[model samples]
Target: MTAAPVKNLTLADFLHLPYVEESPAWEYVDGVLQQKPMPKTRHSMLQKRLLTAVDAATEDYTALPELRCTFGGRSTVPDVAVVVWERIPVNDLGEPEDHFTLAPDWTIEILSPDQKATRVIDNILHCLKHGCRLGWMLDPDDYAVFVFQSQRETEVFRGDRLLPMLEGIDLSLTAEQIFSWLQVKRR
Candidate 1:
């Protein structure tokens, strides 16, 4: 006996599927289901530090980690998703909507050891093609970041060079500064 071939899930079905916040996020890309790689210590540290840094640097935008964004017929969970305050949808009572049906203003992904860069880059490009302002792919091990912008070539940043930031955001983060988050200070 052989196992049955798994059927691809539709976007609606994928969205309707039960999800637990603590579990790895599920993504639907081109009618395929994928599980985002679990964040390791370095990845988690960068995600948290980047989110805090971005949020602290600007009041016009907010950053969230592992937030699922659906748009352009695909759903992706970026390591850090930044949305402009004005673009965030609110409900009748003025609370933020639970479901984000649009691409984030800035999509950030930190590369994991077991994750494939091409796939991550594909997601970023997908977001860019669908109105995302900027994308950053951070490689912790290399202490580098790849920046993506619509209608432009991808740029790599390292050392003291500042990474590209979304418009309206006042952050001036560098690759070195971002990678430095992994170092634990011993008192």
Candidate 2:
């Protein structure tokens, strides 16, 4: 269910509001607080696997799990956020900032069973509009993945079809392998 806006708020005002960082995860979009559905085992499995794969394969780009990104007049926490080494925000001591001020280079979202695909897609599109190079919406229920490239059409990848990685990432993964991570091993 969509969370209705309690009141119209500017980006600055919304940032000051408490509990956005606390679980259950809340997203601020269209001046409303939208609560993210709880993640199931399948959702957590895929998110972890993808982040690990992308992080290991690329040296210049790093993928972080559940990073809250604030940009494009909205604040959201992508399941995974991949940003280039230089683009990562750092403070006076060069440590990464608590919050990202710009859009991620790539954003990944895993679909919860009760969530609407359009809502996730809209978030991906919003990221693309503000300099996100790529986005992926993983739907475990449908066993399909939607790949979004900046300025291009959305493409669905399934089964053994290779999911595209970032320009220099060099990691080749398939939808089958991604979903397989959810399967528990037999003892």
Candidate 3:
């Protein structure tokens, strides 16, 4: 027995349809629709690491994982988002919904081989413009992290030193330490 074929649909059509368990992953860019790739192992590892670090630093605050958020009409699934606990809205059942309409306080994106740098940068900028306090783009190949803060210059970290962002939260891991974790063999 064979399964039924799925139809190729536009972003507009995809949005109008009810959310399903097996909805095709989609991203909208300037009114154009693009499919996102499934993350690879390296990408997954880095995302988990970053999430863990941020979660530890922001334990007192509410942090969401892989939540679909809409900003500037561009719905995206950021790897991780940190929201102040007080800002989260509770439904009638006193539970948070799966989707969030508000911008996150912080957004992080891990680069995949198939993803374009320019597109990722655009997303980061979009987040900044939408009141996101901070954004980070992690490049696996270069083992570098780019930090963005609204109305401030972007900072690039390539060595072993803590990347700044967290306030009142103490974290000591540096950029070099993060990249070193990607290595299978250390010199």
Which candidate wins on lDDT? 2
Q: Which stretches of candidate 3 lie over 4 Å from their true place?
A: 1-14, 18-24, 184-187
Error of 1 at 159 (Å): 1.0
Q: lDDT rank, highest first?
A: 2, 1, 3
Minimum summed lDDT over a 10-residue window in model 2 is located at 1-10
TM-score, candidate 1, is 0.93
lDDT (0-100) at residue 60 of candidate 2?
94
Residues 58-79, model 1: lDDT tens digits: 9899998888898889888999
Q: What TM-score goes with each of the models?
A: 0.93, 0.95, 0.82
Residues 69-150 of candidate 2 have per-residue lDDT tens digits of 9887889889999999899879999999887878899999998988878889999999999999999998888888999998
Per-residue lDDT over 104-169 for candidate 3, one digit per residue giving the tens place of the 0 to 100 score: 888888888888778778877898888888888888898889999999899888887678765754
Model 3, position 100, has a per-residue lDDT of 74
- Misplaced by over 4 Å in model 2 are none
Question: Which residue runs of candidate 1 sit more than 4 Å off their true CA positions?
Answer: 1-8, 19-22
Q: Which clashing pairs does model 3 show?
A: 159-176, 161-174
